[model samples]
Target: MPKVLDCLVNVHFGEREQPAWMLEVRDKYFKGPQSMYRQVDLAELIDEMDEQGVEKAILMYSIVKPSPTALKFVEEMPDRFALAVNGVDLLHPVSSLRELAALVHDLPVAYTTVGPSFWGDGMYPPTDAVYYPLYYKCAELGLPLCMNTGLPGPPIPGEVQNPIHLDRVCYRFPELKLCMIHGADPWWDVAIRLLIKYENLRLMTSAWSPKRLPDSLLHYMRTRGRDKVIFGSDWPVLPMRRLVPEALALDLPDDVRDNYLYRNAQEFFFGGRSAGGTAE
Candidate 1:
């Protein structure tokens, strides 16, 4: 297997399990077994990662703040894990920015996230001034901002997540490294156009299975988007054991596959280190 670095993983390390509401949503929409939501011991998770050739993974918390369980995972295996903060309250921009700053200040935070549907009841669009402060802070810190850009799995209001909303964001905060996670869905064309228009934006294949990825995105990944895309398992949501092999089996150029698997992520989060090393 080629080197791999999962950009968005929901790790159930320690005593934490995925919240019940989220699991209920997955059970309702997903067609397969709910095995992805099953909790596993940290050591068991590590064994699976090792078995799958995942060099590192960014542990993202699903709620409104960073989870202690994620911190504990990083603390226990600093070389194997990094943190991503999610669900910051855009309603209170100032406090949110401060909390974001504090999280990055005290931890190995790779980036911060905004789940348009999950936060503020899916009312705030990506371009809303409410998200500006967070965007500004991320640009200031040279930190990447990951957002849910497609129709969300949970039945929350999804109009707030249109990929079009990011056009203004990229134009306003040109320096912020923005990553759109989950698939861009119905708006793949718009997402593709915006990615072409913004040097700092990227698309991450996280929750969507590789074979299920839209043809447009696969074409983009194999062609001009080689360096503009990254990989993520959204773990348990799609276990590495299954996700990695499917990704590696894609009919992509070797270089494009390499970039999708790890190289682009290295540049995105680790300043383009050429050697095999963990993401920070």
Candidate 2:
């Protein structure tokens, strides 16, 4: 089996420590006794990754206040994990950027994530000036800015999540690396166009099950966009056993499979350092 790097996994500190929104979302989307939303221990997560053949994963945390435990996990096991800091307060752009800088200055974080649909007023487009500072900071740090570009997990207005808003952001900040999470679904065609247009933008198949991935995305992944797409199991929302197998089972060529499964993420997060093996 090819090595894997799951680009988006959510790890709670513990059962009782999970956020209310998480429980609400779980109740809404996941039903039955076998749902993956049940509390997850860090050790259990590592075990699951090992069982699923995932060599490394990027743990995404809430922007409001990233879990200290999540940070500790990556710190303790740097080789097995990397952090993706989500939800920066764009309302206070300057100070938020400084605070974010301090947070990742010496940590094991690979990128900063923003959910345009859930952050701030929920109406500002991704290209709004409020987000420019954060983008500038990310560019300065050489860290990719990951954005949730489709319907968010929590109950929120989805209009702001449109992939079209990113055109201006990408054009304005050409040097900044952007990772569009969730495949920008429902508008993935627009995403495909953007990916083709921008060298620094990438897309990860987070949140969506592999079987549900659009045919357009699959075609792009196997051909022209091969180097621009990566794998992400939005864990707890989707189980590893289900996600890994389905993704690997796709009718993808060997080169595309290797790139999507790990190489793209390795380069995106670690500047070309493969997490499991030498980069091809």
Candidate 3:
């Protein structure tokens, strides 16, 4: 298998089991889901990555972003990972969003994560005024927006699943590269149409099941023929060992599969940057 760089996995402090929001999410949606995030540590995660041959992973976490986590990985290994930062918590109704923009400047940041599912609690609708400042921060930084567009978490309602709601943000921040995950879930067709229409928008097929690489997703690639799709396996839930092999075994054209597997990510995002830098 080509080296798998899982772009989004979360790791958190084991003792930090009391973040009110997380506890709320656990009570509501994580009814019986394993609490691995609180269980795994760097050594354990690295051993798994080695055993599975996962070359790298970009973390997108709750209390903090992945860039800091990547810094930790690189400090010991110096070349194993990179990250995208998600600044959604800047929504606390102060100059918090703008202040975060300044804080991020000193950090080894990449993109900021947000998704409609995680919007209000999931990806909030792009039309909500609460998100404008965050959008502005994204555009200013030239960092991509890691927008979630997949299965709704239990805490999120059904209405928030549509990816079309992001149209307003796309229109307003044309300069910001929006990386949609899970191919924007059910409204994938709308997402593909948008991708074909705008060069600035991109999507990852990370969580898409091979059995159902939706018609629109396949059609857009076969016809429009762009190499924007990147590999992203929602690791931990779907371990890299399983997800990578399944993706490798898909019935896609060799080139398409390669791009989806590794090329697109190496080109569009990190561009071969060597890892290892702490944010000032």
Error of 2 at 232 (Å): 0.7
Model 3 gets an lDDT of 0.63
Output the better candidate (1/3) by lDDT. Answer: 1
RMSD of each: 2.4, 2.4, 4.3
lDDT of 1 at 243: 90
lDDT of each: 0.82, 0.82, 0.63
User: Candidate 1: worst 10 consecutive residues by lDDT?
Assistant: 271-280
Model 1, TM vs. native: 0.92
Tens digit of lDDT per residue, candidate 1, span 79-160?
A: 8888888767677777767877887887878878878888777888988888888888899998899999888887788988
What is the per-residue lDDT of model 3 for residues 108-188, given as tens digits with 9 covering 90 to 100?
A: 455567666655555456668877777776777766777777565544564565667767767878887778876676777
- Displacement of residue 216 (Cα, Å) in model 1 is 1.3
TM-score of each: 0.92, 0.92, 0.79
User: How many pairs in model 2 have backbone atoms within 3 A of each other, for residues 3 or more apart or on separate chains, i.e. clashes?
Assistant: 0
Shift of residue 54 alpha carbon in model 3, Å: 2.9
Off by over 4 Å in 3: 13-15, 18-35, 51-53, 62-71, 90-95, 119-124, 271-280
For candidate 2, write residues 36-154 as lDDT tens digits: 54556778888989998899988876557667667777878888887888767787777677777877876777888888876565788787888888888999999899888977767
